[model samples]
Target: MIATSEISPIATLSMQISAVLVWLGLVFLTSNILHRFKQDPELVRKVVHIGTGNVLLIAWWLHFPTWLCVSAGVTFSAIALASHYISVLPMLNDVGRKTYGIFYYALSITILVALLWDRFPEYAVIGVMVMSWGDGMAALIGKRFGKHTFVHMGNKRSLEGSFAMFVTSAIVMVIILVLANGFRFRDLGVVIPVAAIAAILEAFSPGGTDNISVPLSSAFLSYLLESTL
Candidate 1:
């Protein structure tokens, strides 16, 4: 991990830009391959969605400046919105016309990154991980193996999926906190509740709004819990 004090703004900015381009290219390539093979487009979209969150981990490791992360988020959000309105990038557009979850996803990411990139960088990482691995795996598991279902906001939700989300989010939070701050039994008091709250938020969120709600809820609770403890 780069020391926070050692981060060079100019170098970090260049690295951030390059990382964005590379990540986008990978998403494009993955989308094309999935489309060509007649794979489930929604599955492909989730894979890309989950993978995209790693950029936060990369930035955190490099100790990137808050401005660069926020700028990238804004730029990406604009591109995503443009694609939605004008078909500028069809590969990234995998949802229906009525749902603005993708836009919300970008906006939520921007907000969390901006809010947590400074003193609470670990919260930012936890938020992205919950959104990525927890949410992504839930969809994948729910679609493939879900047998029992419940309704939330007019949408069918699987018990299995919610369980996956809770487990995944909790496990990822523990792992991240351990790596960044060392393992402490006391931290579980914070981690467990944050994971549970985030999972519930994702399960109940209508349309794609979970994209916004899950991370925001997770980050906020994590921040709040950490601050109090």
Candidate 2:
């Protein structure tokens, strides 16, 4: 971990701002390219979404300060909110509903970085990874191979999608926990329950709300499990 004392405040702020700008630019460019090619907008959106979340792994790996991560999250959220209002990024807003998911997604990222970055950074990464890989795969698989469906809160969900979410989440959490906390029977205890909860939340969450629900739930469960152990 990089000591807070090692990084000057100005340097941290500049780095954070630059990273956010680059990320936003990439999102804008990628969206336009996908549109130009007449690609599957939903798939492209989820790919970008998952990629955006996973990029935090670079920050975590580099031992960025929590404040820097929080700043990036805030900056990203502001831009997303502006885009939502003005339709500046049509690809991101190409979803079925008019919602504040981008805002909520940014909020969740900020919360995880602020709360878990210092003490349990691995958990933070795990939470976001589940949101990224698990959620992303579920949507992709659900759309392509979702024949058996059920309705939840006026939204259609598929058993295949939920299974995808659960399996992916479980695999991610288990691997991360094993690497970070060591492979033990106790770790399995934590992994199973957390993955199940995350999958359920994703299944029930309507529209873009899963952006908030999945990571938050996974982070909370991971924290609780770690605290007890």
Q: Give me the candidate number with maximum lDDT.
A: 1
Candidate 1 TM-score, true structure as reference: 0.90
Q: What TM-score goes with each of the models?
A: 0.90, 0.86
lDDT tens digits, residues 86-121, model 1? Answer: 876565565444467778888888998888888888
User: In model 2, where do residues sit more than 4 Å from their true spots?
Assistant: 1-31
Kindly report which residue stretches of model 1 are placed more than 4 angstroms away from their true locations once superposed: 3-9, 95-98
User: Each prediction's Cα lDDT score?
Assistant: 0.82, 0.81
Deviation from native of the Cα of residue 74 in model 2, angstroms: 1.0
